[model samples]
Target: MTRRPYRDLVIFARGGGWGVDRAADGYDPVAVIRGTDFAAVRSGRTETVPRRWEKRTLIVPRRVRPGDVLLEISGGSVARGQTTGRSLFVGPDVLPAFELPVIPASFCRLVRFDTTLVDPRYAYYGLLDMYLSGRAGDYENQSTGISNFQFERFLDAELLRVPPMAEQRRIAGVLAALDDKIEINERVVTATEELLRAEFDALAVTGHGSVPVTELVEFNPRTPPPERAGAPYVDMAALPTHVAGIRSWSHRPPRGGSRFRNGDTLLARITPCLENGKTGYVDFLAPGQTATGSTEFIVLRARPGVPPQFPYFLARDERFRGHAVRKMAGSSGRQRVNAADAADFRISVPSPERLAVFGERAGAAFTHMAGLLAESRALQSLRDALLPELMAGRRIRPAPAPAVTGAATDDAGSSVYAQ
Candidate 1:
């Protein structure tokens, strides 16, 4: 093992580009992963990654590959204590999520390690440790309210402890195993939700009757405030665009916000959020518990006799979303859809018997998804706890030979080796 300057192990490092919006004469479309998308992309959620056209010449050089790392070079919120040096490791499992060729966005840079000197996965863990330890913040420069990572300075000043190749692979393998499980869980949850959507679409085509949505769902229904001083509070940002589950929340004093109980759907009422498909199902709260959230939420709850999960699928329905979008009023950017307008929109309702059957299936799927999410959280906690100790060469000692497989493969059978 030896300590060396961080730059010594890097074979390539360059900032990314934001190509034109349209595919011009010499441009090809590519998926651009931005700093904001690091978490989603890492979790195998690629729907939010934007597509942009870039010159083939530029694309060839910036194209992302398995084993590379995407480093955020700009943009962070001081108030949130977020630094600009966060990174995402592009493992074999993450590449298939993109339909087009992938590249980091302008505010990010692609980093590739020298395989002979350090394992890319091991290098990534080192970078992650730096960020998690807040050491990355030491190299940040603030200007005009935006934080920028001083990449050159970081490379010159930081030192990394590199072990033998076999040891590097062993350490990386242990961490990757945890990540692989989390990724698999996410994929399963995504597939389950997609299946539910398909079932909902099928039912929509053969419903018993048509009626105003208000008859089935009560929008923004009034509810009594929680008695607890600090109740679970979900802000607008906690709402997910493509998934039904809300993964994050905080405890705060309830002070005049939309209040909802479990089994309710929270839809973003504001322009960009609504248009971007920001919605969530309230299933994280304890049984009979009520939570408060952003006033920008329009809570949708099923009426008696309706399926409890109906409002969530309805909120995600294309036709229902289009109606809500068309009903937007107020100023341009701040436009919002009225709760009454959304409630008045009509939809075909399945017979009570059929509804009950659909509910049984969808409810089971959601329960399974919730369980998977809980497991992922636990795995994440375990990974976080082990990361620092392993990186510091404590607790687990390096093996004489690699204790795991030489390469990690994704569901598509594509493989990424330690190199």
Candidate 2:
């Protein structure tokens, strides 16, 4: 093993992508992967696909290649979990798992590794160790107004410690085991949610009834949050931008965010955040208890007898999200959806008997999804706990057998674009 400059191992790297508004008529739904998408994938939440782009848009000249890793270079992406200056491997094993032709957006750099000099998988894991292990600060340059990672400087000066190919495979294998299970768990949650949506759509097709979202959901519901000592606070980061669940919450004064009780749906009202899919169901709190989150959230709770999870999937609707995005009003960057407009969203409602049945079935599915999320979280903790030690040539435990058989392979046949 020897330490070397990263530039010696990389063949080419650059950033380019057409604006979503600039996408013209074409059959290809060439997806421009932004910093948010990169962060979601890095967190093993690959199911959060951005629907901000037109699927019929033309493919741009800048596209992903096998072995190309998209690294977020600009913005506070590091704090957002994009891991500034880190490489997100887009190898054949990883790309096929996604739905569309995911090209790196303007804020990201596409780095195609020189496979002859470096094993792509190994290089990816090493970068993960560096970035996720909090070693990214040494390689990042946030001095400019924007947080632009100085990849060139890192390539020129940073010492990249590379192990032999055999060792790299072993290390990647061990880490991939934990990641594989996490990915599988994510797939299960995604599939189950899709099925529930399909069932909801079926109910709509049966001519059950149509009603304004307000009839079934209360917008901006009020709550008297507790003090910091006992309050459970959920920030925007605690909510997943793409996935269907909240990642974490804390006991902080519920002083600033919108308030809501259990079974409420929190949909981000701000620009880019709403467009990125930051909506979640509130089940972490007890029935009588309440929680607070970013003021940018619009809380929606089901009316009596309505399925608690129904509003969550309703907010997840493509048409509903489109309407919310269109109704956003304010400056270009600070736009937010008006709660009244959100309440005006129309959706189908099944007959009481049918709705009750759907509620029972959907509740079971959601409960199972939560279980999977919990399992994945625990597995992620184990992996994160072991990542640094394994990367540093120090083994905490005997390396397990390779987990690549199911790793990076999407067995569920989920669409590239989330449903």
Candidate 3:
């Protein structure tokens, strides 16, 4: 088959290298792979780091200009066309990622379709969804894992046989609208959460009313045995931001690295991430469900009036994490937080009436946010389901296979996605 020459389109690397941040996974300011900004940047690490990149930055070539295509050839899993989508600006810091010889830009037809078919930002987020979709599995392990999409395969599987340019544009447009809404809704949720957290932080209930966590809660640690399989397991990756429940699992729950009952709080006791807000309250679990996590968490179990949702807020609270850090900074073996330090950390326990009011209101807000987030994810699923087909000219707004039934969803009556 004669291929279209993409020689004229501008191409650049996509993912930032993980090397700089490997030493400190949580807060490496030198590389963006683990930085604080959940928002994507085109180049340079967003955090302030003492060490600067030895090589070039991550932006695009001056000749190609800003509107040119930004293709990410090598990334998390090195197949091909791993990053299949649209990008515009080339951030300066992104340059160093392409210093190696084995990696190639020309593998997957990385072209700059610098036209109006897709919004660059929307396409960027879409590409991320593609990458994150396969996070269930480690890098390339498949059986129970989702394999990463390399750029080469991406071209063969995605780039080579896309639908007519017009249809690609249409599909991209529809998907962009849904993502745009999702982004807006997410921003609203963040702002609401910030407002609530700020109010909780400033309340005049810190002094005499303060009590040690050990008084009202229990610190129980479980160690994972040599055995690696049996029951479902909760890897660190399973923990998401603001979760009060565990949804995903990888290995079986270990014999005992840590334990948590429903409504217990799980705080990552390690560095960087402990600072990055990686705590969650256990609100939902199946009947007799027992999941274990990496030895990196301090499970907070309340005695009684310590409203269940309170852990959710305290987990997000800077004060709780601050005490957690000061206590662990001097620790010896494996950087773990001691149960006594947890006991030393203090928080004001308001009257049960006040806590009940706070917990009920906060929990309701969390449920609402979770619902919205769940809906956004479902919309994303719909978009993904249609992408390959629509881009391949196999599906469209109106159906071609009239009355044929499958997992495909129409404009309305879509399946509600949840665990």
- lDDT score, residue 114, model 3? 35
Q: Across residues 1-419, which tens digit of lDDT does each residue of candidate 1 receive?
A: 48787889888997899999987998999999999898788778898899999889898789999999999989987866788888999988788878899989999999999999999999999998898889999999988889999999999887788988887887787778777877777788988998889988888832433677888899999787886778899988789988898988889887878999999999999999999999999888887788999989999999998888999998998888888999989987899998998876777878888889999998998998988887677666656766787777765433232111223222112212222
Candidate 3, residues 125-194, lDDT tens digits: the string is 3344444454312223233322333444453333223334554445555555555555555655666666
Arrange candidates by TM-score, descending.
Answer: 1, 2, 3
lDDT of 2 at 151: 78
Q: 1-419 in candidate 2: lDDT tens per residue? A: 58777788888777746445544555455556776576456444555555335434323445677777777777665455544665677745556767777777778888777777777766777677777766666666656556777778877875566777676676666667667777777777777877888887777722333666778778887666655566788877777755567868877755676888777889999988898788998877776787777888998888888889878877887778888898999988999988998776666766899889889998998888888787677667667766776666653533333222354333211111222
Count of clashing residue pairs in every prediction: 0, 1, 27
Distance from true location, Cα of 44 in model 2, Å: 9.8
lDDT of each: 0.84, 0.71, 0.47
Indicate which candidate wins on lDDT.
1
Predictions: Cα RMSD each: 5.2, 6.9, 9.5
Best by TM-score: 1
Clashing pairs in 2: 99-416
